[model samples]
Target: MKRKAPSNPVTQTQKQLSLEDDKVKALFNQKIWDPKFQDELKDEIANAKPYNWGTIHDLVDDDLLRAVRKEIETEIHFTKKETDIYKVNQSGDLANLSGLDWNDLSRLPNMYKLRQILYSEKYRDFFGYVTGAGKLSASKTDMSVNTYTKGCHLLTHDDVIGSRRISFILYLPDPDRKWKSHYGGGLRLFPSIKENIPYTDPCAKLVPQFNQIAFFKVQPGFSFHDVEEVRVDKHRLSIQGWYHIPQKGEDGYIPGEEEAWIDQNISTLAQLESRTLQDFEFPNAEREILPFHQTKHYERLLTGEEDNNKDCKFLSEALKLTEREIQYLSQYISPEHLTAEGITKLQKSFEDNSSLQIESFLNDPKSDLLKKLIKHDELNKECPMEAKDVKAPWKTATPSHKWRYLYMDGKSHEYFATEEDMLENLNNEEPSNFKWLKETLINAKTSNNDNELEIALVDLAQFLKSLIFKKYIATLTLLCPLAEKVIIRRFRPGKDFTLATKCNLSEVLKGVEGFVDAVLEATLCLTPSNGWTSGEVGGYELYMADETIDEEEKDDTQYERDVEDATVYRRDDAGDSVLINKPASWNSLNLVLRDESVMEFVKYISWGAESSRWDVRIQWDVKSMESDV
Candidate 1:
C-alpha cells in the first residue's frame, strides 16, 4: 500500500489549526459569546459618542494571549518606521502568514493560531454583531503588530479605505501591570465639526490594557482618530487589524457592494483634490495678491525702470540694500545677512539648491530679546491648551485633518468655530492690519508685561509683511513677489502638526505674465530649546517630492495597503525624494522655492519635547526673474 504514506505531520498540524466554532470560542474569554453580554455590548456601541465604538476587557484567554505575545516577542522582528503621519516599530503584515510554509508557521505557532482565531468565522460574527458592522470577510486577514516606544505616535486620520468594514486594536502591553492613562499611547477619538472635518482636539480617549480589544465601524467622513505619542520609555504593544467587507464567496457578499462603498469613501488623495473639502481647510493655501502699489516697487526695481540701467548694473543695484533700508532692517536682521556680499552669496546658494538656511538671521538685540521673551513664556505662562482658550491675535489652525497649530495671520479676525464663521468672514472684508504691531511696539517701549511675547511675535510678523522685508527676500531668492501671506506659528509639544501638502498657487496668479508656478516659502525658526537636532523629539520640517503612481502599475489594493503601511509609500528611504529636513532651531531662517511638485510638513511635536516649536512661516506668490526683467 506504498508504505501507508507516513502520516503527514504538516498536514495534521494544518488541520489541527483550522479554527472550528468551539475551538475559537475557547480561545477568547467565555463571556464574549454570552447572549446577554453580546446584547449589552451592542447597546453600548449604539450609544457611544463621537461615532459608534466598543471595547471589551479580557477579550482573549489569558494563557493564550500570553503565549501569543511570547511568540511575537521571540519570532517576529520589528522595524522602526517614521513617516509624515506616524512613527512606530512595526512588523510585516500578519496576513502573509497564510502563505508561509508549515515550517515557518511552526516558529510562530501561537501567533498563527491567534490570527486564525481572530479571523475565524465565529469570532468575526461576534465582532460584527457587537459593532453592527455586518458581514466581515474572514478571507481578508489584515493585521500587523506595532510597538509604540518613546515618542512614537500617529496623527489624526479617519480609517476609511477600500473594503475596510471595521477597525480594531488588541492591546498586549505588560499583562502583569495596569496600563495607566498617564503612560500615553492612548487611542484618541476626535469628534467631527461637520462631515470630513474633525475638531482641533480629541474628546474621547481609551487607555488600553493587556487582553483588551477596542473596535469601531469604519465610517467615512467621520471616525477621525489618532494614537497619542508614547510619552514614556515603554513598549506599548498592540495588534492592529481591519475586517473587510464580505468577499466573493462569503455569506453576506453582495455584488458591487464593496465597489460602491469604496466609491462613497474616496481615497485621501482624491479627497484632497475635491474642491468642496478644500473650503474647510484652515490657513488655506490661498495667497492674497499684494496691492498693485506695493508690488510696483519691486517690478520697477527688477526691470531697471527706477534707474534705467543696463542688465548687469540693474541686477547689481537691485541686489544692493540702500542705506535707509539697511538702517531700518539692522534693528531686526543680522548685520551679516544684510551685507551686499552676504546677500549675493544667499542668492547664489538659492539658485543652486532652490533652498537656503541662514543661521542667526536676526540681529543680536532682536534675537536676544525674542528668545528671552519666548523662553520665559514657555516656562512661566500657561500656553493655551484648548481652542477656546486661544486668545486674540492667535488662532488655532483648524479642521485637524490637514493641520493643527496656533497661528497669528497678522489679522484681527475672531476665533472661527464653524463653516458658517468662515463664510461670514469671507463675506465681510477684513484687510490685513498692523494695529497690533503698533500697540505692541508702544507697549515694548513702555512696560514689560505678560503679553510681551505675543506682542513681540506680532511685531515681527508685521515687519516680515513689510515691503522693505519683501525687497530683502526678493534679493535673496531672486524672485519678485506678486502676493504674500505671513503667519507666526507655534507647534505645541504633543498637540500640533501640519500634514504633508503641496503648494496651491492662487487662481489669479496661475497664468499671469511673469508668474512662476511656485511659492517662495520661508521659515524663521524661533524654537528656543536645544535637544531637537536629531529629530527624535519630532519637530522637524521636511520637504519631499510628491510621488505619483503610474496608472499601468497601480494596484487595486494600493489604497488599503497605503493606510496599513504608510512607510512603504514615503519614498524617503531612497534619500533622493527628500529635498530638505530642518530640525527646529533658534533664529534660523530657511527659504525654499517650492513648486507644485514639492510636499512639505512640520512633523508632530512629541510630548517629550523640551518646548514648543515656534516659527514665522511666510509664503509669496512669485514671478520668474527673466519674466520680470
Candidate 2:
C-alpha cells in the first residue's frame, strides 16, 4: 500500500489555531459563564434607563487584552478622518480575518485569539442571553478600531441598518488609569420623545474603562446615542463591533427574517425624507412663495420695466441699487459691496464659480455694535440649555436626529404634539410682515439693555428680508428670487448642529416658468470670538455633492446597506465630493446656489469653542434671469 500522504503542515497549524472551548473560556472573565452573574446582567439590561443596555468591567483577560493592544499599536495603521458627524482616527475593519492565512494570523496572534473568542459560540450565546437580542451570526464579523483624540466626536444617530442585531464597544484605553467622565468620550444615550423622535439632550451616559464592554440591543427608533467629543489631548481607543442577525444554517436562522426586519425599520435617512414627518420638524424645509405682487416687482425690475428702459444690456445695470437706495442700505450693508463696480465684480465671480464669500459684508458701525453685543452676551449671560427653557422669538430646532439649533424665524413659538396641531398651525399661518420687526429694530438701536444681541440679530434678519436687499442679491447673483426665508440662527457650543441634508424643493415649483430647480443660499457669519480658524473645535459649515446613486440603479447589496446606514457612507473623507468647508468667522458672507444634488451641514460645536456660532441664514427660491434680461 502506498504510504499515507503526509499531513499538510499548514493544515495542521490551522487546526491548532482553531480555538478550543476551554481555551476560549479562559480568555474572558470567569463571571461571564456563571449562571447567577448572567441573570444579574440580564436584569440590569432590562432595567436600564433611556434604553436597554448593559456593561461589564474587566470582561476580557487582562494579559490577553494588553497583548492585543500591543499588537494593534505596532501593526495597525490609522487615518485621521473628519466628516460632518465625526472626527476620529480609524483602522481598517478587523473582520478581514477570513482573508488572512496562518502567517498573517501568527503576526497578530493575540488579536486573532480575541476576535475568535469574542465571536465564538460560548460568548455570543452569553451576549445574546443578556441583551435579549436573540441569536447572532458568527459568520458575520463586523468590527473596527477607533482612536478619538482631542476634538473627535460622533454625533447623534440610531444604529439601525441592515441585519444588525446589537451594537457594542470594547474599551482599550490605558489599563493602569481610569477614564474620567470629564475626559468627554462617553457614550451618551437619548430618550425618545416618541417612537421616531429622540429628545434633544442625552439622559444617560457611559464612561468606559479599559477591558470594559458596553452593549445594547439595536432598537431602531428608540436607541439614539452619540459619542461626546474628546476635550483633552488623550487617545481614547475602543473597538466598535456589531452582532448581526443569523444567517442560513445558524441555529436561529429564519428565511426572510432579515428582510422582514429591514422592511419594518426605516433608516434615519429614510425617516428624514418621509413626507409624513415634515410637519413634525421645526424650521421645516419649506419656503413661502414670494407674494405675486413682490414677484412681479422683481420681474419688472429684471426686465427693465421698472425703469421703462428695455434697452438695458447687463443684468448688473438693470438691478443696480440707486444712489438713494445705496445710502439707505449703507446703514446695514458695507458701502463697498453696494458700489456699481462692486456689483459687477460680484456678478462676474458668482457667474464663474456659482459661489462667493464676501468679507466685511456688514457696515463697520453695525458689525462692531453687533459683535460687542454678541461677545458680551457670550461672556456674561447664561444660555438656556433645555428646549423647554428656550425663550420666545428664539425656538430650538427640533426632531433631534435631523438638526438642533436656536433660530429666530419672527414667529410665535409653537410646539406641535400631534399631526392635527401641525395642520392647524399651517392653516392659520399668516403672510409675512416686517412692521413689528422694523419697530423692534428702532427700539433696539437706541436701547441700552441686555437684549441688544437678540435685537441686533432680529434687525439683521429684517434687513435681509427687505426688497431692497433682495435687489442687491439679484444683482450679485443674476438670479431673480421668487420666494425666501431669513433665519437668525445660533449654534450653541457643545449642543447645536444641523446634519447633512439636501434642499427639499416644493413640488409646485417643479415646472414653473424660469425655475432653476435650485436654492440661492447665503450665510452671513457673525461668530464673535477667536481661535476657530483651524476648525478643530467644530462649527464649520460643509457642503458636499450628494453622491448617492439612484435607488433603482443600485445592484450591490453591501453598498445599499451602507447607504441605509448613513454614517458609513459619510465616514470616509472623499476629498473630491466636498464643495465647501467654511469655518466659523466674523463679518463674512457665504453665498452658494445649491441644487437638489448638493448636501450641507454645520458641524457640531465643541465645548472647547470660545463662543457660539451666530449667523443669518437665508434661502431664496430663485428663477433664471436670462429670459427676463
Candidate 3:
C-alpha cells in the first residue's frame, strides 16, 4: 500500500488547523452566518440612513480574544503618533505577519490564529455578501492596533486608500467593563455636503463593546467617519483593518481595478485645492475691493518708497475722510497709535518684518469695559459647547475636521442668510462709515446692557474697520481700502481647535504674481485663565512652513509614509517658520501677515484650562503694487 503514504503528514496538519478555525467560528454569535440573519443584515446595511454600514456583537470567542489582547499587551511595543487629524498609540503594521521572525511569531500565536480566522474563506464570503464589495484579496492583508487614551481622537475622513474594498474595526476595550457613550471613543459617521465634502456634524454614531465589530464598504467620496475623542481617562483599544480587492492569482482578480480605484478617490488635500469647491465651502474668502489707483498708493506706503507726508495726503484723499471722521475714531482709538510718529515707526517695523503686536489696541476706557464684560460672561454665563446650541450672533465653524470654534460674523442678525444676503441687507443709501461709527458709539455707552457681550464684540469690530484704523493699516502694511472680515471667536476648554492649514488665495487672486499672496490676520486674545505657560494647557497659536516635497517623492508611497502627515508636523521640525507664536493672554493683540506657503493652527485647548480662549479675529485681502513697479 505504498508504505501507507507515510500517514499523510500534510493531511494531519490541515486537519488540526481546521479544528482550530472551527473553534474560532464557534466564538461568534452563530446567527451572524445564518441565511435568514444575513438577509436581514443585508437589508439593514443597504437601507441604513446617512451611509451603508453594519455592526455585530460577540464577533469572536471571548477566551480567544482575551488571549489575543494579552498577547498584544505583553508582546508589542506601541509608539505615540500625533497629527492634526489624530492622536493615538499604535503598534507596527500587524498585517506584515509573514515578515516577522520566528521569535516574534512565537509570542503572537493567538493573534496569528485570530488574523487567519478573520480572513478565512468562510467569513470572507459572509462579509462580502453583506457588504456587496465582491471578493477580497487572499494575498493582501492591512491592519494595525491602536489605543486611544484621554484626549485622543481621529478626525473625519473616508478610509479610501489603494485597492481597499472594506474597512472594519474590532473593539477590545476592557472586556470586563461597559463602554459608555459619554466616555466618547464612539465611531461617528458624517453626512455629505456634496459629492466629496462631508458635513461638519455626524449623523450616526456607534458605541463599541468587547467582542464587537463594525464595518462598511470603503466607498470613496462618501463614507466619512471619525473616532470621537476618548474622554474620562480610559484606554480604548481596537484593531483596525482593511480588505482589498482580490489580488493577482486570487479568485475574481481584476487586472487594473485596484489602481483605478485609488486614482478615483480624491484626497482631502486635493479637494481643498479645488477652486470651485473651496469657493463654495469656505465661509470667508478674502475679497478684492481696493481700486487700482488706491492699491498703488497703499503699496507705496508699505515699501517706504514714497514721501511720508505725501503718502498721508494720499491716504486722506483716497479714503475721502473728513476731519470729523478722524475725531470720531479718536474717541475709541489709542491716542499713541493716532500720531504721525507712531504711525511711521509702525510702518518701518512692519515693512522690515510682516507682523506686529499691539499691546493696548483699544483705548484704555474701551479696553477696561470689554475685559470686565468678557470676564463676567466667562465666570457666570453658560457657554454653549455644541454647534447646535450656538445662538444667533454666533455660528459654529463647519466641516470641523479642519477647525472648531464659535464665531460672531458681525452680520449674524442674518444668521440663516448667505453672502449675497449681506449685499441686500446693507443700506447702500447710507455711507458705510456713518453706519459703523454710529453703532460703535451706541455700544460704547451701553456697556452695562444685557447684550453687553454682543455689543462689545461689534464695537471692537467697528474700531478695527474704522477709517482712522484703516489709514493706520494702509500706512503700516500698505494693505488699505482692503476687504476686511471681523470674527469674534470663543474656543472653550477641551472642546475647540483649528488644524494646521495653508491660506488659500481667492480665485481671482490666484496666479497674480507681485500681488501679496499673504493674508493680514489679527487676533485679540482674551483668555480669563493664567498658566497657559508653555502650551501645557494648549490654547497657543503656531505658524510653520509648508512641508516641501520633491517632485520625484510625490509618486513614491514609501517616501510619503516617511514624511510627517500633511495634516500635522512636529513642533520642533526644521523649517522656515515666520515665528509669531503667542499664548492666550488677557488684553493682548497679535498681528501677522501670513502667506499661502505658511501653515497655521490654534492648538487644542486642554481640559485643565481654567477658562476658554476668547478673541476677536480680523482678516484682510491686501493688494500688491509689485507688478506696477
TM-score of each: 0.92, 0.90, 0.80
lDDT of each: 0.79, 0.79, 0.68
Task: Name the candidate that leads on TM-score.
Answer: 1
Which portions of model 3 show Cα errors greater than 4 Å?
1-29, 92-99, 291-353, 357-364, 412-449, 474-481, 493-495, 506-514, 534-538, 548-551, 554-581, 606-608, 623-629
User: Model 2 over residues 180-211: C-alpha lDDT tens digits?
Assistant: 99999999998986777788788999997999
Ranking by TM-score: 1, 2, 3
Worst 10 residues of 2 by lDDT: 1-10
Cα deviation of 611, candidate 1, in Å: 1.1
Candidate 1 local lDDT, residue 505: 83
- Which whole-number lDDT from 0 to 100 does residue 227 have in model 2? 91
Q: What residue runs in model 1 are displaced by over 4 Å at the alpha carbon?
A: 1-16, 93-98, 299-319, 415-429, 436-449, 562-574, 627-629
lDDT of 2 at 483: 77
Full-model lDDT, candidate 1: 0.79
Clashes in predicted model 2: 0
Per-residue lDDT tens digits for candidate 3, residues 524-591, read 88776798866656688777776655555354333323323222123331235536677888777787
